[model samples]
Target: MPDTPHLAAQPALSIFYQLLQFRDQRRKGGGMEAIATTLTEQDMRDIAAHYATLPAPAPQTGGDAQKIARGQQIAQQQYCSSCHGAQLQGQKHVPRLSGQSHAYFVTQLRNLRSGARADMDGTMASAARSLTDEEIEAMAAYARSLP
Candidate 1:
């Protein structure tokens, strides 16, 4: 709980500013847009630095068993483990859902559910489309309960 949200969001804001600057420069006949479209080594370094600074969410335990079971059922039905791993530890190019901040998970899930977050494969968006808000909450809770 060292206010990781503020620190994590800074890079996102910086990226947004970088995008705006690139757009402005492109409008002025600058080729920054092409460069900006591709993620540079420095951009990857910056992102890695920010991720390293972030503390993993606090470990959770002792949630309603029935709700967790139901959530697990939904997860299985949707084959969430295919990308998230058997324990939700996450796979390459996928993010860890278990042990993530509840607020963060909720926001992202909502975005995915609503098609606000543009996913490349659209897998998450399609999975989320079938889930109700209550199911999302239950899923989040179940994930939080895991290590």
Candidate 2:
């Protein structure tokens, strides 16, 4: 199984929306549905707020240089920063991509590409559509290397 996402320092709005999706059965996996189903709106909000106040996850190291570079190139070409922020730290409703676990990132990307994941506005699905398996791996490598 892929690792759970590191939610610390993620935007509260993003977390809140994701929780709503899980609670409503829009986004599935990681047993979040079961957990979210028990949360009231206020409970979700408080959870989001709490996670947002925590520090970001530490940067991962030892990624392949070439793969990271290719991923950076792909990210730029994809205009990821337009919604994700300059450093991929995420915007109001965009989850932070930096410092994500490689396995988790790749799985989510694959899920988005396969239409198995729920994209809030279809943007993530659109963005992920053209990515090849190699590209996804490289992108995950890049994301894991960020601080």
Candidate 3:
């Protein structure tokens, strides 16, 4: 069962939770480790293949229109559209910002600003550094409004 009621709403997170459990099991150095090591290379490859085949997540379409409009303006001013698509759909290694939960999005932005997040090539860190909490909140709101 999900640890929290909200967690049950995000079924996709089960994959990450399972991965963390697998890592913890390996670290414990006992029966769990044995099970972790039992996965054949082919099995790992198949898992990766399946992940690659998963469909792209649908863009989010739920938010207050006023908040979304404000966020859009903030994103443009912040140059977020330069890296994330103009629609916040993401590109290459950059993650899609659209459809992410507002809480999760805000937390990531805060982490980036605080230097707690390890971003590729330091671009996100630099971008985040210039954001005030209000801007971060606006960005999250805007990103979650895309569809």
Candidate 4:
């Protein structure tokens, strides 16, 4: 399962921020500066907390269970869980692979493998080095099978 609450809240922060702005701007001519000053750490945390209630996303892909199995082997051998989490559902700052499109997964892996995509520390790039295109496809298939 994913940290759905955080994922859900990440996209809605703008709305909560805007509400904060409105509440803070009630005085001082409603200036942006005043609104900025009015925003407390607690206020931000409160807004972020709203999304912690969302449910996890559903599984997105099916078929070729063998490909998924092979992908699992590759992922394990590559030590992917060290960063992406044990299930590849992602952790803080890492995007979930479970429900992503296969094309997206393949493209990202290809880019990362080739250094066309930017990784925070080149870890993905290095991990992707030994992956063949077929392996990438298998990994994508496997990732889609996760919940």
Candidate 5:
């Protein structure tokens, strides 16, 4: 099974937006739809706030150096930080990428690329459109290696 995302330290607005998407069936849920449906708007807001107050997850260790380097290069080339924040810590409705689970990140990227996932804006889809599978893997490795 894929690793679940560590919601701690994520932007509250981002979490709330995702919850709304899941609730509205605008995004692919993978079981989140039912849970989201049970939440009132206030419940979603409270959940987002609670998670945002928690400490961020620690970075994964022992990643391949080459992959990390390539991922960093790709991220810079793609200007990922322009929206995700300088250290990928995220802001407002944008999600934090630092320390995200590799499997989940990879899956999301692929889904974005293929239009299998719904993005609030087309930016993520556009950004992901040209990525090769290798680049996706490298990006995931880089994100996981962050502190």
Candidate 6:
């Protein structure tokens, strides 16, 4: 059972609970580190199914072209379009960034840059780590302006 009821609404929190359970078990004589090293096929399947149920985000639009163009240059140089989509519609597994709240985007980017958030591909973390504070601000601003 979760320590807090609010966590019940978050599947990721449940996953983290399971991970903690595995870690605790490993500390004992359970010795299942190898098995706990990665997610099982069932775990992956369940997560994918849950992820598919997420509602599609609403579109957002409008921003200065010059600012967006500068952001686009940074994005292109970073090859962000390869995963985020040329139009910022987002691709498989990559979360929709366009239309996301600027503050949220900036926070997540900072998390990735600071190693506070574990990016699946390591590419994002590396890319974020290379970005200056100004670049992150610009990217977040541009992403928030996309439709």
**Per-residue lDDT over 27-58 for candidate 5, one digit per residue giving the tens place of the 0 to 100 score:** 86479988999999999999999999999989
TM-score of each: 0.66, 0.96, 0.64, 0.63, 0.96, 0.60
Off by over 4 Å in 3: 1-62
lDDT of 3 by residue, 114-136 (tens): 87755546788998898888878
Clash tally, candidates in order: 0, 0, 0, 1, 0, 0
Ranking according to lDDT, highest score first: 5, 2, 4, 1, 3, 6
List, residue by residue over 60-143, the lDDT tens digit for candidate 6: 466666766777888899988887788665655455566566766777688789877565558778878889888887887787
Tell me the lDDT of model 1 at 133.
Answer: 84
lDDT of 2 by residue, 19-91 (tens): 9999999999989999999999999999999999999988878789999999899889998868887778898
Candidate 1, residue 96: lDDT? 63
Q: Candidate 4 lDDT, tens digit per residue, 65-145?
A: 899899889889888867676788665545556655677578768878987655555676898999999999889888778
What's the residue-level lDDT of 138 in candidate 4?
88
How far out, in Å, is residue 35 in model 4?
A: 23
- Candidates 1 and 3 compared: the better one by TM-score is 1
| RMSD of each candidate relative to the true structure | 7.9, 1.1, 7.1, 10.1, 1.0, 8.7
lDDT of 1: 0.63
lDDT of 5: 0.91
Q: What's the CA error at residue 8 for candidate 2, in Å?
A: 0.5
Candidate 2 accuracy as TM-score: 0.96
Instruction: Please give the CA lDDT of all the candidate structures.
Output: 0.63, 0.90, 0.62, 0.64, 0.91, 0.61
Q: Give lDDT tens digits, candidate 1, residues 25-131.
A: 52221354676657665674576457535655555777788888887887788888777777775545556666766666777678788876555467878878888
Model 1 regions more than 4 Å off: 1-40, 49-56
For model 5, what is the alpha-carbon lDDT of residue 58?
Answer: 93
